[model samples]
Target: MRYGLAWCMSTFGGPIGQALGLTLAEGAYAPVAWMLLGACWIAALVSFLDGRRRRRLLASQTGLGSLRAVDWRQFEMLVSEAFRRQGYTVRETGLDGSDGGIDLILQRDGATTLVQCKQWRSQLVDVRLVREMYGLLVHHQADAVKIVAIGNYTADARRFVHGKPIELICGDALLAMVRESQAAGTVSKQTRRRA
Candidate 1:
């Protein structure tokens, strides 16, 4: 379950609570049912609004300058959305509190890829960070590891993944991906409208 969904469930008790409340609605319990139903509605609205906000953020990323303006969590969401557009099933790991774990897990054609997103506007990703990502790839037995950043990577970081199953996407390269994904989304929407 996603972190947001889990939190919603804990706070609102979700559809199950709504159903139970409805079934038990009587002279004394009617108010409780209405309250539970209202809570569920609020949770659903919040989830929908959040998803819309993330989509808007991804669509507005036109360049490295725009990318740099996003927060770390938004950066992760943007990367995840880009990969999803490329046909990967993306799962956000919700590790925003710490910088030590994988931020997204991508699966396509039975191969898994771990993604680490860095919203470092002024800091270049160094070889040490690339090495740590490589270690995580090996530890998780994943097919590949991708580190996406708003800035660039050090030359040593680029060299470390020369022949490895690690990809360092940063700066212009990352911007290109976001652009391609955005173009693809637009084309698909147009196609759907035509049909």
Candidate 2:
């Protein structure tokens, strides 16, 4: 249960009521004063109840652990789409245990890039995955190796890719880029509409 929004609304309601009451008190006749106060209270009550109900519904739909596990294949598709938008020809290699840790092989501008997709829950990606991809890149003579973790990354994992040409896309960063792309499309539509 997330009560933070409810708590803030309750806390702020007191000061808001006081300010509104004081303002209304200074105004006109008895009927108008009563009506204004009643309307304010009703609006506040409706808003609070609506917020509570919405929160409850959202919580029920998406439980606390809902974000923990995501399908790796779906994530692979998302990454492929992301790369495609960047003008790369992406290929899904499935699980190649012998081919090292390469899960996706991408080609662009005659340069081949190896990508490993890890769809984890709250687990932090460690340095070992990075090392494995680095070995695969060298073995396959790939121009670049990318390790995209669809979750958080450990400090060591970040440090491991710091100097290397390896790219790391955490869950939040990936989502942000997707949002940016969506927003760009929306803006383009609006511009065309204005024209």
Candidate 3:
């Protein structure tokens, strides 16, 4: 019963599930339940594939102009997908809202790295943001902290991160990562096709 409730909630939700909960258990409506579940799964697959396509499109574009053009959410998604391709287990934190705090938690080789995505257009990432991330790093005891920006970092920001377990990725550096991740995805797809 609990599992049925969970499935109904996930597949239909709210009033629809409430109305169908009894029907779902009825022998006559078993086909209806299966059909609705199949539809839900298909929608999920399409949504996942579409998001992958959008991430690939974002990665294939060259230069910071393309990066800055995406909204804050898409920018974060692009960064998350890139790191995932680069072998990190990425978790989107959605902490401190959409535009601030640790936006991603990356795990690789038993080490956890917290990431902050800054999609600033004209301004450089300043020391204040770096300092805050450092504080988070210490508090969370993460292996490292990374700040990914569409623009460059300020001199103070650069100085603060030097010799620390913090990596600042911006401008050309970020573009290189995008390109590398994009290429990695392509190679894997080709390999799978050939296999």
TM-score leader: 3
Clashing pairs in 2: none
Cα deviation of 91 in candidate 2 (Å)?
0.9
Query: Model 1 over residues 1-195: C-alpha lDDT tens digits?
Result: 234334444458778855544444423455655887899999999989977876788799878888888777788888988998999998889545664568999999999999988888888899998999899999999999999888889999988999999988878889899999899988988999999
Q: How displaced is residue 105 in candidate 2, in Å?
A: 1.2
Best lDDT among the predictions, by candidate number: 3
Q: What's model 1's lDDT at 135?
A: 94
TM-score per candidate, in order?
Answer: 0.76, 0.56, 0.77
Better of 1 and 3 by TM-score: 3
The C-alpha stretches of model 3 lying farther than 4 A from their native spots are 1-36, 39-43, 95-100
Please report, in order, the local distance difference test score of every candidate based on alpha carbons: 0.83, 0.66, 0.84
**Pairing residues by index, what is the TM-score of model 2?**
0.56
State the lDDT at 135 in candidate 3. Answer: 94
List, residue by residue over 1-195, the lDDT tens digit for candidate 3. 435654675477777776566555553465665888899999999989967776676556787788778888788888888898889998888633763488999999999999999889889899999999999999999999999998889999999998999999988898989989888878988999999
In model 2, the runs with Cα more than 4 Å from the true position are 1-70, 95-100, 181-195
> Which is better, 1 or 2, measured by TM-score?
1
